[model samples]
Target chain A: MTDGTPILHMKDVRFQWPGRASFSLEVPSFEAGRGEKVLLLGESGSGKSTLLSLICGTIAADAGDVTIDGTRLSDLSGGARDQFRAETIGVIFQQFNLLPFGSVVDNILLPLRFAPERRARVSDARAEAAALSLALGLPDVQTAKAATLSVGQQQRVAVARALIGRPPLIIADEPTSALDANSQAAFLDLLFDQVRAHDTTLLIVSHDARLGERFDRVVQMADIARTTERAA
Target chain B: MMLRLAFGSLRARALTVTMTVLAIALSVALFLGVEKVRTGAKASFADTISGTDLIVGARSGSVQLLLYSVFRIGNATNNVTWQSYQDIAARPEVDWIVPISLGDSHRQFRVMGTTPAFFDRYKYRRDRGLELGDGAIMNDLFDAVIGSDVAATLGYAVDDPIVVAHGLASFTEHKDQPFRISGILKKTGTPVDRTVIVSMEAIEAIHVDWQNGAQIPGQSTPVEVIRQMDLTPKAVTAALVGVESPLQTFALQRAINTYPEEPLLAVLPGVALQELWGIVGIAETALLGVSAMVVVTALLGLMATIFSSLNERRREMAIFRAMGARPRTIMALLVLEAVLTSAAGAILGVAFLYLGLMIAQPMIDSAYGLWLPIDAPSTREALVLLGVVAAGAIVSMVPALRAYRLSVADGMMVRT
Candidate 1:
C-alpha cells in the first residue's frame, strides 16, 4: 500500500561528536518506502546508532537534510522535534525498554502521555493497551511492575508499547540481542505480524546477518556510510 | 501525569524516600518548635501582669525592676522608703496599690509582702484574678498565703506553720516568729504560682528585732509584743499601681518618676516587659538559629539522597527521553518529587510539634511558669512551612539539572 514517495529520506548527511573529529558519519543517500521492513546490518563501531539518532532527531546533523513523511526534521525546533518524534515515530531499544517501576499497562500507555495525537487516535487508551498486551501474548499483568516480568515478557511489553497508537514508522535497535535464538525468532515473528497489521514501515538495526531473511530488504552500513578513520 | 510518575518513582525507592522525608520532618519540627517556644515565652512574659499600669521601684533599670518586682527574679538595687510609697499612692490618679516587699524566702520560694488589696486588685493574663484554692486571704500579722507551686511542692496546707528565711539563701531562718499558711492560691501559670504572699504587717513583725540584716543578741522581741508595737513597714521593694483611666498611665508614671520624696523610678509595665524581652530575645534567636541550621542540614541530606540516586536513574531518564519527554520534563519530574517529599515532611513535622507540645505542656507550665496554649499555626509558622517547601524544590534542582544534562548526553543509549 506504499505510495511512490519515500516515508523517510536522507541526503548527504554528515555528523560528528563535538570532541571526536576522527569519528564521523557520512550518508550520501538513503530512503525507506511505506510498509517496508528494512534490516540495517552493521558491525560494532559502525554508524548504525548514529543513523538512528539522526532519523529520530535526538541530535542535530552537522550538514545535509533528513526528512520524515514530507517534513524536514532540521526545519523544526528542538521542542517541536521531540513532539514530532512522539507523534510520528515509535522506538524500541535493545534492552531496558520498559520502565521498571511502572505497571505493565502503564509501560504500554506511556507514549500517549506525551503525544496528544496518539491519545486521540484510540477510543479508550487503557482498553487499547490491554488489547495490545493480549495480542502480544502477555498475561493480564496490568498491575505488575515491569521488573517482575521475565526478559522475554519484557521484550513483548516493549513491542506492545511501540505498536500502541499505530505511529507511521517503527524503529527497533538490536531488539533481540539479549534473547535466545528461539525467542528471537518468535519475537521477530510477533513484531512482523504487528507491523504488517498496522501497515507501518519498519527499520531494524542489528549486527546479526541471519535475521535479514525476515525483512523485505537488507542494507549494509558500508552501502550508505563513509567513515573517516583516525589513528588510535 | 508527571506528578503521578514522580510519586511512582519515589515509591519505587520507598526506604530512601522515607529516610529523606524523616530527616526533613525532624528538622522542620525543631525549627518550628524553637519558634513556638520563643513566641510562647514572649507571650508568657507579657502575660505575667496585665492590669498594673505602672511599676514603681527604687531607681533601677526598667528590666531590673520588672525582674525583681513582677517576676520575683533578681534583687532590687535599693528599697523604696515608706514615705515615698505613701507619697506615690496618695496621687489622685492612683486608683489602688499593691506594695511589694521582697527580700525573704519561704523555703526558696519568694515571700512577697503586700496588703489584702493585692488579692482583690492583682490580675494576670488579661484580668484573670487569682482564685483561692483553699482557705482565706492573709489578714493578720504572721499570716501567709502560699502560691500553687509553693503549696504543692513544699507540701503545705492551710493553717500550716512555716518559717521564713532572712534572705534568699536560706542560711538564717526566722525561727523566732513562724508564720501560718492562711490561704493557698490556685494555679495561675505566672510568677505568682511560685511566691509566698503575706501582709505587710507580717513583714514588719519579722524584721522588728533584726538589726542590720541580723537579729540583735538578747534584743529579740516576742512575736506578740511586735504585733502590738506598731507593725507598719519602714520600706518596700516596689509597688504596682493601677490608674483610674487608661490615659492616666503615662501621667502616673511621669509623676512617680519625678517624685520629690526619694529617688524613685516608675515604668510602664508593658514597656519594661518588652525591654526585658529584648535582652532575653538573643537567647531565643540563638535557639531559633540552631534549629534553622538543623533544618538546612536536613534539606542538604535530602539533596544528597536525590543526587546519589541519579546514577541509578540514568537509564530511566533515557527511557523517558525516548518516550518523547524533553530534557526539561525530566528535570521537572525530579524537582516535583522533591517538592512532594518535603511538603509531606513539613506537614508531618507540624503534626509532631503539636504532639510534643501536648506531652510537655504540663512540665513547661510548672517549671518555667509559662503556659503554652494549643493554638492554630500562626502566620509566621505558615510562612516557615512555605519556605521549607520552596527551599526543598529549589535544592532539588541541583539533581534535576544533573539528570537533564545526562539525559541529553546519553540520548536513548543505556551506557550501563
Candidate 2:
C-alpha cells in the first residue's frame, strides 16, 4: 500500500525520439510507494526501457516531471541529477551488470565510490558488501573476478550491489532474463528477501508475466503508457 | 577510484599494455642514449688535449692539425722540418716543445714518437700527466711505452718485443728493428689510451733502411750499428708548444705561422678543438632529432592503442555510468591510464638505457675507442623524461575527450 507520498511518482510524462515521427511514449501516471515491490510488465518496443530511462534521469521527459522520494528530477541539473540518482536509487540490468574486471566485492561497493551519501549509510563498505553477498546467497568468493562467476551468481552479485547502500528505490530491468527457470525462481526469492528486509521500493521491469505473483502490484504497459508507431 | 579502474583495466589487457610500454620504453631509451653519447663524446673530446697552448705543423687546416697531431686520427699532410721545431723551441716565449712524429702503427694502434719530456709535459683532462702503470719511461734506443688500451689488447708486458708497422696497416712491418715494451701508461680515457709511445731516436732508427716511404730491397741497416749512429730526428709531423706565459701564446703562434723557412700552420689547441667539436655537434644534433621523432611515433602508437580499445570499452563506460559515474569520470579514467602508461614507459626507458649501457660500454669502448661513462642521468636528461611524460599527458587528451563524448552518448546503454 502506498503512503501519502509514493517513493516514485510520474505524471503525464511524454518522451519522443528526436527527429522521429512516431513511437512516442506517454505515461499518464506511475507510482510505487515506499517498500512496495512493483513489477512493470511490458513487451519489447513498449516504451518500458524509455520510461525507466526517464525515471532514472538518464533521459528527461519532454513534458512532465519525475519526482522520486519528494525530489523533482527536473529541478536538478544534469550533474546534480546523476548524483541524486546515485544516492536515492540503485539499478540492475539484465546481464553484464558487474564490471567484469573488478572483484565481486569491488562491484558491490561501486555505488559507494560514486555516492558518498549511500556510503555514509553503511559503517564499513567491505563488511556490508560481504554481509549483503551472503544474504543474497552468493558464495564466499567475494575476491574472485566478476567474470568468473556463473550467470546466476553474477545476478546475485548485482542484487547485492543494488541493495548494499540501502537506497530508497531499486530499479531492475529484466534482472532474471539470463537465468534458467530453476535459477530464475531462486533469484527472485533471494531478491525479494533482500528488498523486504531493507524495506526498499523495487520497480522491476520485465516482459515475463510469471514474476507478477511475487510483486505487490503488477503494472502493465498498456494500462499506463501509450505508444503509437507511425507508418513509415 | 579512477586509479583503481585504470590499473585494473590495464592489468586486464596486459598484452597490449606491455607492448605499448615497451614501444615507449625503447623510444625513450634511444632518445636518452643519443643524448648520453652526444654529451660523452663532447666531454671526451674537450678533455683530450689540455694545457697545450699551440700546435705547430706544416701548412694544413686547424681541424686537420688537431685530428692527426692530438687525436692520432689521420695522416698529416706534411711534416714540419726539425729546424723549424728547434727555432720555435729556442724562442724566449716557448717554455717547452714536444715534437710529435706519426705515420706509423703497431697492431692498428698509432705509434707516437716523442721524447721523455712529452710524457712529463703533455697533459689532458686539465693538468693530468700520463702516469706509468708498469715499468719506467723508454730509455733504450729500441724501447717503447704502450698506452693502457694497447697493453690490455695486445697482452704486451714490460719486456715484450713489438714490431712497428710502417703505416696504419701491419703488412709493411719494421721487422728488422723490433721495439721492446719498457712501460705501460695508465688509462686516461683519451686518444692517448690507444697510442704506442716511442722515443724520437727509435723512430729515426727504424726508418734507416726505408727511403721515400718504402723499405729498400737490397739495403738493410743492422740494429746494433743503427743504435750507435746519430739519431736526431730530421722532421716531425707536429709539435705541441707550451708558452712561458698564457699572454705570449698568441704572439708565439703568429711568429711560428709567419716563419720564412717553410710554409707552416700554428693553431691554438683550444680554438682548434672548438672548431672540431662544431663539426661533430651537427651530427649529434641530427641524431637527437631522429630519436625525438621516434619518441613522438611511440607516443602516437600509445594514442592509437588507447583509441582502438575505446570502442570495445563503450560497454564498460556504460556500466560505470549506471553505477553513477559521470562522463567526466570516464574521461578521467582514460587520461589516468594514458598518463600511467607513459610515465611507466619513461621510467622503464631510463632503466633500459642503463641496462643497455652496462652491456654495451665495453663493446663501444673497444669498437669506437670512446669511453662513455655510465653515470646517472644529467639534469637535461631528467628534463627530457619529464617532456616525454608531459607529451604523453597531452597526447592522452585526444582519446580522453573522445571517450567522454562516447560515454555521454552511450548513457547506461550496454551496447555490444
Candidate 3:
C-alpha cells in the first residue's frame, strides 16, 4: 500500500573502493514509493551494506545523485546532510544497537536529543517512549540498563528507538539474523504492525531469503550491482 | 546533551577515568607543592633581617657575611674587634648598631649574643618588632631569651636553667655557668625563630677561661670568679648598622670597606640576600623542571587512556554518527571529556596541597626552620593550573582526531 510518489530515488549512482579495481557499485535507477516495505536481498559481500551507507548519506557517491523525500542528499553540505539524516531517517544496526550504559528509555529518547524537529513532533517524549516500548511487547524495563536486557528484549528496544520520532524511512541491516526462528517471526509481525500503523517506508537489507516473502517488494543485489565480488 | 553523553561514557569506564584523574591530580599536586616550597624558602630567607642598612664584618664574601650574620648559617671567617664596632657606632652618620656574636648553640639551635637592641631594632616581615611571648628580655649576664621555636620544641619555659654549648656543637657544653631562660620571642616565620638570644656578657662569661677555640687544661675560671670579672665582649662576629639617613648607607658602606684598622667589608643586606637567593634558585629551577616533566607525563597518560579506548568506542562513535553527530561533534566530545578530567584533577590537586600543608606544617617548621604559610594560590600557581588544563585540551586532540577519522571511515558500520 504505497502512494504514487517516491520516498527514495536513486539515479546513475556509482561508487568504488579507493584502490580496488575488481568490483564497483552502480545503480542505474531505483525508486521506492511512500509507505513501501522493500526487502533488499543480497549475499554478504554483494555491496548491500555499501549501498545502504550511500542511501543513508553516510557515504557520497562517485557520480550521480540520491534523493530522499524529494531533497537531493548530495546537494547538502556534510553537516546539513547529518541533520537531514537525523530528521528524515532512522537506522537500526544488527548488533550493539543500544548504548550499554544508557537505560532503555534513554536509548529510545536519543533520537529526539539529536533532532529537534523529531523532538517537536511529540508533546511528551518520555510518555511516548513508554507507550512505544509497551506497544513493542517489551516488559516494563525502561529503568533497566540496556546491557541488562536479553537479546530479544534488546532487539525490541532497538526497534522502539528506531520508531520513536516516526521518521519517514527506517533502514535496518540484518536486524533479525541473530534471532531464533520463532523470535524472528514474532519480531517481524510486530515490526510490520508498527510500520503499517505509521505508514512509514522500510528498506531492510539481509542475506537471508526467508524474509523476502514478507515484504511488499524484494530487490536482488545481483540485479542492481554489475558484479557480486567481495570488497577488500 | 553532549555533556551527558560524555559523562555517560566516563561512567561506563569508571576505572580508567579514575586512574587518569589520579595521575593528573598527583602530578599537579607535586608541581604546586614544589612551587610553594620554593616561594616559602625565598620568603623565609628574605624575611630574616630587614631595616638594617649595612652588615659590617671582617673582609669576606658578601653572601657569606649575610648568611652568618642574619641566617645563623655557616661560620664567620674572622671576628671584628669590639673597638671597631664602637668606632663605627660613634660615627655621626650611624644612628644605631647591633653587634652579633655567634658560635654557640643549645640543642642544635644557634645561640646569638647581642644586646636588647637586637629585638628593638631588628625588624622582619615589614618592620614588625619582635614580641615577647613569655617573661622579659635578657636583664642579667646569665639570663637568656629563647626564640618561639626553641621554647616550643624543647619545652623550655621562663626560669628554666639551660647550659649553653660552646663552638656550635652539643658535645662541648659550657656547664660551669648555666643561663636562666628569661623570655621567649614569638614566632616570626623567619630564621630568627630558631635562634637562642643571650646577652654579650653571658657569652663573655661562658668563654672567660676558653682561649683559641679550646679550654686550657691547667686554668679554669670558676663561676663565682667569672661572675666577678669584667664581662665585656672583646670581639664580635658582625654588626648590623642603621644609618641616620637612608642616603648615607652607600657612603658608610664604602667607608667601612676601606677602613685601615683591619681589613673589613660592608654589604647591603638586601643585595647580599638576593645574591644568596640567586645561588639557591638553581636547585629550585631544577625542581620546577622535574615537576613540569611530571605534569607532561600525566597528560600523556591521559592521552593514552583515551586513545586506547578509541577502538573499543568505535561502535559508540558510529552510533553517534548515525544519531546525527558530526565529525567535529565527536571530536568535541572527546576533548570535552579530557578538559573536564583535567579541571577536576586541578581542583583536587589544590585540595591535596592544602591538606598536605595542614598535616606537615608543624613538621616543616621544626625540620627546616621554615614556616610555610598556608594560604590561597598566588598568580603563578593559578597559571600552572591553567597551563595544565590548556595542555590537557591540546593533548586530547590526539585521540579526538583519531576518533573523528575512524567515525568518518566506518560510518554506521562497525567491522569488528
Candidate 4:
C-alpha cells in the first residue's frame, strides 16, 4: 500500500494545437496516489477537458511524459494505446454519458465489448452490472433504454458503467454539475464508497468549488498548467 | 457483431429504412418486368411465320405486305391477280404455293380463303404445320375450318353455322351463304389462332351476286344456285412461297419482283421481320432506359437517406470511438447495412414480378396475342439482380467513408 509510486504522473508535459498560435498547455508536475480522490478545479475555458483527454490517452502530449500506472502512453502504438485505454480507464462525461439507444445493462457492459482483458476480469457481466446498479441506488432498470431515465437516474447509471469492470482509474468530467445539492451529496457518498472498496484513483474536473470538501485534495488548473507564453 | 449493431441501428430508424427499401423494390420490379415482356414479345413475333421462303403481294411497303399477309393487321392496297400467282407457281425453283385471300370478318376475327394445300404448306413456330384438333378439313362448298381461338371465342363446334360479313367493320352479311364449321385447328400461338379458314371457291361464290362491294337488291343468288355456278377465283390477296432448295430463295424472290406482267412485291420473311424489329427496337430500348433510370434514382435516394442520417449519428460515432471501436469497424458497419437493404429489396422485387405476371397472363395474351412463358429467372435476370446489389454497395461508400473520417478526427468529442 505504501510503495510511493504515483498511479498518475505528468512531468513538464506540453500540448499545442496544430496551426493555432494563441493557445498551449504546460504542466510542470502532477501526481495522484493509489486510492486517491483528486478534485481538479478549473473554470469553463481553462483547458480541463484537454488535460483529461491527454490523461486518457485520446490525445498525445507534444513534449514530456504522460504516464498512467506503469505505462507511458507515447510508447504504445495507436491500436495498442486504444486497447490499453479501454483496459485501464473508464470515462464519464458531464451529461448524457450513456448511449441513448442501448438498454441500461447493455450500456453498462459496453467496455467489455472492446477490451477482452476487462471482459475476462468479470464473471457473469449482466449480474455484475445489476449488482453495481443496485449499489449505486438505482431500481431494476436493466431492460429500459437510457434515454427514458431521469437526469439523476442517468448519472447513477453512468457511475455504474464506470465501475462495472473495476478499472484502475475513473476520469469524470464535471460528473455532478447536473445534479441538485442533496443529490450531489448523495452521489459523492455513493461514488466514494465504491472507489474505496475497489482501490480506484478518481479524478473529477469541475468549476464548482463546493465539491472541493469531499475529495482528499484539490488541484487548481492555474497552479499546474502555465498558459502565458503565446505568439501574440 | 458489427452486423448485429448495424441492424439494431436500422431498426431504431424503421420508417426511413422501410421507405428506402420499398423504393428499391418498386424500381427493381419494373426493371425486370420490362425485360421479361420485351423478350417475350420478340420471341412471339419472330415465331409467327417460319419455313416460308418469301411472301408476295401487290407492290407496296415490305412491312405493309408482311403485316397483311402474315399478321393480318391491315389490308393490301391492291390484290395479287390469280394470273401472277399462277406465273410464280410455275417457276422451277418454287416447290409449293399457298395462296390466301382476306377481306372479310366474322365477329372481329379475320376470315381467310385458301385451298386444302394451305394446311400442308403453311407453317409456324419453326416448321410446325397446322393440324386439325377436331373434326376434318373443309369438305363441302360452305364448310369452314376455324382456328382454336375462333372456336373458343365464338363457342362454335363441328356443326355450328357462321355468317360472314363483307368487310372488317361492315354490317353487310352474306346471310344466305352461312358456312358450317367442319374442323377446329390446334392452338398455334400465331395470327392463325384467330383466323377462320374456308375454301377459295367459297370466297368467290359469296361475292358472285355482289357488285362494287355490295350485294345487288333483287339479284341475290340462292346458296343452292351459287353452288352450280363456276367459282374460280379471279384475284387473290397474297401467297406464301417455299423453295425446293434454300439457295434458290433469293433468286426466286428476285424473279417474282422483276416479273414484266404486273407490279408486285416479293420479300424474304426473315428480312421483313428484322425490319419490323428495327422499328420497334427504338421503343423497347427507350422503355428499358426509363426503367434503368428509375433504379438509379432509387439508389440515389438510398445514398441521400444514409448521408443525411450521418449528421445525427455523429454523436453515436463518438460514443463508439470512446468504447474503443476502430474507424474501419464503423465503415464496415455502414456498408453491411446497405448491402442487407438492397439484397432484401432484390428478393422482394423478384417475388413481385412473378406475382404480377401470374395475374396478367390471360389479359396480356388476349389483348396483344403474344404468349409469355412463365419460367424461372434466366441467367441475364439473375445477373441484373446481382448488379443492383453491387451498385447499392458501391453507393454506400459515400456515407461509410465519411463516418470513418469523422470517427478518426473527432475522437471522443461530440459537438452536438
Best by DockQ: 3
Give me the candidate number with maximum TM-score.
Answer: 2
Q: How well is candidate 4 docked (DockQ)?
A: 0.42
* B219 Cα displacement, candidate 3 (Å): 4.0
Report, for all candidates in order, the number of backbone clashes.
Answer: 0, 0, 0, 0
Residue A127, candidate 3: Cα error in Å is 2.3
Displacement of the residue A147 alpha carbon in candidate 4, Å:
5.1
Docking class of 2: medium
TM-score for chain A in each prediction: 0.97, 0.97, 0.95, 0.96
TM-score against native, each model: 0.92, 0.96, 0.94, 0.84
Which residue pairs collide in model 1, if any? none
Q: Give the per-residue lDDT digits (tens) of candidate 3, residues B1-416.
A: 56776787888999999889888999999999988899999998788788999999999999999989988889999999999888888998999999999999998799999999998999987798899998999998899999898999899999999998888765978888899999999988777888999999889999887888887677778888887998889999999999999999999999899988988999999899999999999999999999999999999999999999999999888888887778888899999999988997888889988999999988998778777899989998999899899899999999999998888888778767
Per-residue lDDT of model 3, residues A95-200, tens digit only: 7888888888888888787788999997899999999989999999988889899888888888888888899999899989888999999998998899888889
TM-score of 3: 0.94
The full ranking of all candidates by DockQ, starting with the best, is 3, 2, 1, 4
**Candidate order by decreasing TM-score:** 2, 3, 1, 4
Backbone clash pairs for candidate 2 read none
Task: List chain B TM-scores, each candidate.
Answer: 0.92, 0.97, 0.95, 0.92
**Ranking of models by lDDT:** 1, 2, 3, 4
DockQ of 1: 0.62
Whole-model lDDT values for every prediction: 0.90, 0.89, 0.89, 0.87
What is the C-alpha lDDT profile of model 4 across A128-154, one tens digit per residue?
A: 999999899999899998888988889
The candidate with the higher lDDT, 2 or 3, is: 2
